[model samples]
Structure formats: C-alpha cells, structure tokens
Target: VTKPYRLRELIARIRAVLRRSGSEPANDVIMSIGEFRIDTIRRSVVRDGVELELSRKEFDLLALFASRLGQVVTRDECLDEIWWGRDLADTRTLDTHVKRLRQKLEADPSNPIHLLTIRGVGFRLDP
Candidate 1:
C-alpha cells in the first residue's frame, strides 16, 4: 500500500545503489591489464577485444583481485569477503574460483600474467 511518489522514490534509490555498487566513482570500473579488460559494472571481461563469459563467482573473484590490483589476497580473506563468512572451512571453493578466474583472465593459465599465486600465502594481481 505505497503511494506512487513513494514507489518512484524507492525505485530511484534502488537504481542509485545499483549504479554506485557496480561502478567505481573514480574510474570507469573497467580495469585493463595488457589486452584484458574487466568491466565491473557490466560484470564482463574482454580479452584481445573478444568477450568471455564468466559465472557469478568468477566475476566476484576477478573483481576482488582487480580491486586489490597488486596486493596479495589470502584464501581466508577471499572467503570472508566474497563468500560473506558463509562457512567456507575448506579452501577448495576459493581455489576453484581462482582457477576459473585465471582461465578467463590469463593468456596462459599455467603461467599466469595477471593472477599470481604466492604459495603457502595467497594470491596477488599483477598490473
């Protein structure tokens, strides 16, 4: 039982939140590394001018790594942030997501250029 104006206002607020959350205010939310570009707002990744499909987890994982942009993000950190503390006692979920992210973002998944593993520590994104 909401008024028309109230409904309109609610919609406006929702749209604003969506816009703010999906895009970075300073940049275009389109992070580029070499030939790879990740659009945070669109949740899309493009490599060599070709678009690649990614799952929700893949997109979130990439976004987290891109946001760090050179800092190491530990598996526990990722689980806490991305999974929102949802009982990820096992690190395999993080590994799987990282693997998927690497396959999509890296030119060579075996010798990744963007996503680097820190071994016994965590993962880092190399600009």
Candidate 2:
C-alpha cells in the first residue's frame, strides 16, 4: 500500500491488482457520470473529451460522486470518505472542494447541473 492512503484506497488498489491475465488494469475500472469519466485506479478525471486538472482531494471528491450518480450523498458520507474520519465538524473543506469541482465541470458554477447542493442535507450528482 502507498503511504498516506485510506482503507478504501487500499481496497481499490487490491481490486486493481486482482485483475489479471487478459484484463488491462489501466483501461478497466473506470466510473463515469455524464461527461465525467473517473479512473479510480489512476486517480484521474476527464470531462467532455478534455482532462481537467484536479487536486488529490478534488479527484477523490469527484470519484465519490461519479460512483453514485443522481443520488444524494450526505455531507457526513463525503467527510468520512474524503477526510477519513477526521474531526471536521465545522470545516468548509468539502464545500470548497465541491465548489472547485463545479467551477471545473459545470458551465455555470452558480447554477450547477452535475454537482448539486441538497439544501441542508448534502449534495447530489445528476448525470
């Protein structure tokens, strides 16, 4: 396992390693939603035929949404997955990352179509 990675990442690595023989790891294991194609194993995101530069945290954040399109993922769920159980009760880290994702992916960040806020709940990705 790589240094400074979560259990989820280690599991993904193991899954990638488990693909053998005729399978190509790099071409396989991609999660997509709308124009966004998230290569979980490679930790990359490409939207509408163009690859958008994303920070590690931003990639992780998008990967989460890409996996569950059109679903309302709670704020706590995002926090636990990205922050890995840190005490971020009052932090705006997730919000900032989401905003960045919108700016990069959405045509209008103010009124996003892909990444959406769920009022007092969390967020949703409408693919």
Best by TM-score: 1
Residue 25 CA displacement from its true place in model 2, Å:
12
- Summarize candidate 2's per-residue lDDT along 1-127 as a digit string, tens digits: 5588677656545543453334555644786677778887778788888989999888877877765778988987787677754567675888888898889989989988888999888988888
Which residue pairs clash in candidate 2?
none
TM-score list, all predictions: 0.75, 0.74
> Which portions of model 1 miss their true places by more than 4 Å?
1-23, 26-28
Per-residue accuracy of model 1 over 4-109 as CA lDDT, tens digit each? 4354345545554564477456575778866779897789988888998999988887787777888998876676566654565678888988998888777789
Model 1 lDDT-worst window of ten: 1-10
TM-score of 2: 0.74
Clashes of 2: 0
The global C-alpha lDDT for each of the candidates, from Candidate 1 onward, is 0.77, 0.77
